[model samples]
Target: MAPWLIAAILTQGALALGLLWYLGTIRIPMVMRGEVRIDDIALERKGWPKREWQASNAFDNQFQLPVLFYVGAGLALYFGPTSLEVALAWLFVVTRYAHAFVHITDNHVIRRFAAYFAGLLLLCLFWLDLAVRLVLSL
Candidate 1:
């Protein structure tokens, strides 16, 4: 795997770990203290406080777009990636971090959408780069 790719992947993993820590340490304790109903969370987290809900939602967001990221990373590892792909991957990670920050902090819809859209564009470019490379090679 490219070193830049590895660094980007590790950075994303660290973000996930941070979110998991928030969920486990803060959010779960809220349930233990009867601040929120376990049943509510089990159903759809309808009763969760805004802060807790935002944290949970941010955590969930990781698995969504990042799934494609992992797939693209794996393909890049297998097929070898160029600087363009690596740069796009890093940019995508940056957007994800920005999105999570906006989501968990202020819950700003416009900022979050901007970050998400930028990341989506970067991911599309990364995939297109890979596809073009594969086609050219064959």
Candidate 2:
């Protein structure tokens, strides 16, 4: 795996952590208080939807997939990475962050689809890489 790939992973991982930190410390309470903030950073001005403890569950749904992807990517770097694999691994993180942003802040069509498809593609690539490597080694 390339060093730049590691850097990409680290950058996305940091952003994900930042998102979690903000959510736990900020969004959770706001949700508990039935608050939704305007998403001015987004192309649209609509606020996040009303959420309760369901917000926490939503966080879990959002966070869980990427964490697994991160672990898989880390192992690939530690073991080996085809250039294509590294690229896809990096894409996974970028899309995960985008997905999270779409999921939590701005629920728009393009952003939501970009997040979902990117993640699904990466996950497929991750599994394919692992499967082929295992088969070839055998």
TM-score per candidate, in order?
0.92, 0.66
Per-residue CA lDDT of model 2 for 1-138, tens digit only, reads 568668767876686666667667765575456575434314642454344233333356556776667677776776676787778877877787777666666457697787878788887888688777878889
Candidate 2: segments with Cα more than 4 A from true spot: 24-58
The backbone clash count of each candidate, in order, is 0, 0
Q: How much is 40 displaced in model 1, in angstroms?
A: 3.7
Q: Give all candidates' CA lDDT scores.
A: 0.88, 0.67
Q: What is the per-residue lDDT of model 1 for residues 11-79, given as tens digits with 9 covering 90 to 100? A: 988888889788787677888899888887786768888888788889999999998998998789788
Scanning candidate 1 in windows of ten residues, the lowest lDDT window is 37-46
- Colliding residue pairs in candidate 1: none
Ten-residue segment with the worst summed lDDT in candidate 2? Answer: 49-58
What is the Cα-based TM-score of model 2?
0.66
